[model samples]
Target: MRRFAPLALSAAALITTLVQAAPAVAAGSVPGGGHPAGGHRTEVLELVARQTQTTFIDHGDPGTSQGDELVLAGDLLRGPALFGRFGEVCTLTRVGPEPDSFDQQCVGTLTLPGGDLTLQGLVSVTAAGPGEVTVAITGGTGRYRTAHGVIEAVNTSETETRLTLRIIL
Candidate 1:
């Protein structure tokens, strides 16, 4: 019992030191409050998109019409994925938005040998006054089939066009 006295006292002092060193939780501040630990605060905006019936003139020929219904899910600041038939297996990374335009990098796997392809472009928001924004993808490249095709044909053309996208945030 006599020998245990100093040991117990030392243990109590160590506990006191630890308690003093422990970080205090602020009032009304819960664990992991406001934002998640190490997680970026993201604002997700959903947009209902409609492409024009006009096909890209540079791709094949004029009057070649192809329309796509896209569901764009992304952070307003950070670009999002354009999901739909057109976005079956692709991911779009939003770089930043200019004064009236937003930039994005579209990356996806090719269907043939299935190599990776990246298309960088910008979308100009013509109107963002209301709950919706009308945007037009100015231009982008469509480079694909590089893994299986020849080097000459591997380089596909890119275009900037006038297509209206109705974004519903």
Candidate 2:
């Protein structure tokens, strides 16, 4: 499948977030149009990621199997400007006999000016051609320390993808 071509883990991993993580949002802190979610402050961000590189590691087998890994690198963009970049690693935790049936456990990060957002999810391919996936926002490194949300990615090409990030701070 074309969608499974690369970054099956790096995101599947960086669909979206950012803003000046200025100490606090002052209650008026909704950047990119966000609202309160379950009483927690929230924000939404848009981004584009163009996959620049991919590394596939085949382990213990000639073809796809458990222990296989995919490493991905790409750039993050907000509109036409460079927002930041991202990196991800996905491991084949489950492999089915069919090529399109497998799950990748992925951990990825979006390195931005304010902070780094972390994402983790189980990426599975259930269809052909360009694909789409949604993963969870686990945690972060700086201002995004309390950041949690979800990333939805749609493969625009074999090497290009669009990301939507819903961040809850």
Candidate maximizing lDDT: 2
Per-residue lDDT tens digits of candidate 1, residues 29-142?
A: 123223445232222222211121212121222221122111221111112333321221111122123332222122221111222222222221112311121222222223
List runs of model 2 lying over 4 Å from the truth: 1-4, 8-39, 127-130
Question: Against the true structure, whose TM-score is highest?
Answer: 2
TM-score of each: 0.17, 0.78
lDDT of 2 by residue, 23-64 (tens): 211123454335533556666676677678888888887677
Report residue 12 deviation for candidate 2 (angstroms). Answer: 4.5
Off by over 4 Å in 1: 1-85, 88-118, 128-144, 147-169
- TM-score, structure 1 vs. true: 0.17
lDDT of 2 at 17: 18
